[model samples]
Target: MNKKAIVTAGLAAALSIGAISTAQAASKEKCYGIAKAGQNDCANISGTHSCAGQSKTDNALDDWKAVKAGTCEEMGGYSKAQAKELLKKQKEMKG
Candidate 1:
């Protein structure tokens, strides 16, 4: 294969992989209080950090990870409302 053909093929493959991940994410939902330390998919509810993989505590009520839709409860994860409530209580107790 020529260099141009190889490059085009690689680009096509990369694009397809991106599309696949996007579709997978569309089928996912954020599950709170389940991420291990430094494994969160995004920022926590407490606003301590503004990026992924920044959680300082394992299974922090404020931290979350993406899980398959409808499976978070089975994994003992909390919904956004529940996590928020739990974090609120945790903060109050610490003060």
Candidate 2:
């Protein structure tokens, strides 16, 4: 390919990778507890369990932890610390 074309392709590839990473991070889930894995609502977990949560599959730890910390508070009754601990226990139990 021409030099210009090669440069354009490289930039495109970089952008594509960035987009994929961002999307993957966003998909990392958070959970309320061990027994409740698939549900996404933070409120129910906090209301019933006193915890809010998030999850990341086996591969998404950083994103999962961070998102859960920020968003798990919506669970109606949990403090951020409780939500984080609940999520940590759930992850450990899953292992």
Q: What is the lDDT of candidate 2?
A: 0.48
lDDT of 2 by residue, 1-95 (tens): 89999999999999999999888768654533322342233344323423234432322212222243345445333444565676678889999
The TM-score leader among the candidates is 1
In model 2, how large is the Cα lDDT of residue 38?
Answer: 29
Model 1 misplaced stretches (Cα beyond 4 Å):
1-19
Model 1 whole-model lDDT (C-alpha atoms):
0.94
- Tens-digit lDDT track of model 1 for 1-95: 99999999999999999999999989999999999999999988878899999999899889999999999999999999999998888889999
Give the worst 10-residue stretch by lDDT in candidate 2: 56-65
lDDT of 1 at 51: 98
Q: Which stretches of model 2 miss by more than 4 angstroms?
A: 30-80, 84-95
* Top-lDDT candidate index: 1
Q: Each prediction's TM-score against the native?
A: 0.74, 0.36
